[model samples]
Target: MPDEVIDCRGQRCPLPVIAAARRMPEVPVGTVVRVLADDPAAAVDIPAWCRMRGQEFLGSVDGPDGPAYDVRRTH
Candidate 1:
């Protein structure tokens, strides 16, 4: 399970990624944040953000609302 869950299903593109970034600081390192995004670009955007930001992209799965990305805070 994720330490936190941010619902961005209705949001578009960078918004999902941005929302996830904004919520990251609220959780401790090593914890995972599940980002729920409906935007198809999120599948690529989230992983790219993780690679650039040094966060661990634990990958994603089909969520009730959409695809939920499992992102672990590394820094």
Candidate 2:
């Protein structure tokens, strides 16, 4: 499966994480979730959440608005 994009701009802490968690299952293993978030905390929170969830933190990129993360679920 190909990676999917989730727009999390304007969303707060747990919202972005929760939104990603909800969409993650739709994506197959080895695929990634490209989360676009404007939350500054996401720069740290997302990676930590991925780690805690046993997902692969593929890293992030600077988008026009904010940082976007690439997350691959292992399980």
Candidate 1, 2-55: lDDT as tens digits? 888888888999999999899888889899999999899999999999999989
Error of 1 at 44 (Å): 0.4
Off by over 4 Å in 2: none
Cα lDDT of model 2 by residue, 9-57, tens digit: 9999988888888988877788888889988888888999998999888
TM-score of each: 0.94, 0.89
The all-Cα superposition gives candidate 2 an RMSD in Å to the true structure of 1.9
Count of steric clashes across candidates, in order: 0, 0
Please report the TM-score between candidate 2 and the true structure.
0.89
Whole-model lDDT, model 1: 0.91
How much is 67 displaced in model 1, in angstroms? 1.0
lDDT of each: 0.91, 0.85
Q: Which stretches of candidate 1 lie over 4 Å from their true place?
A: none
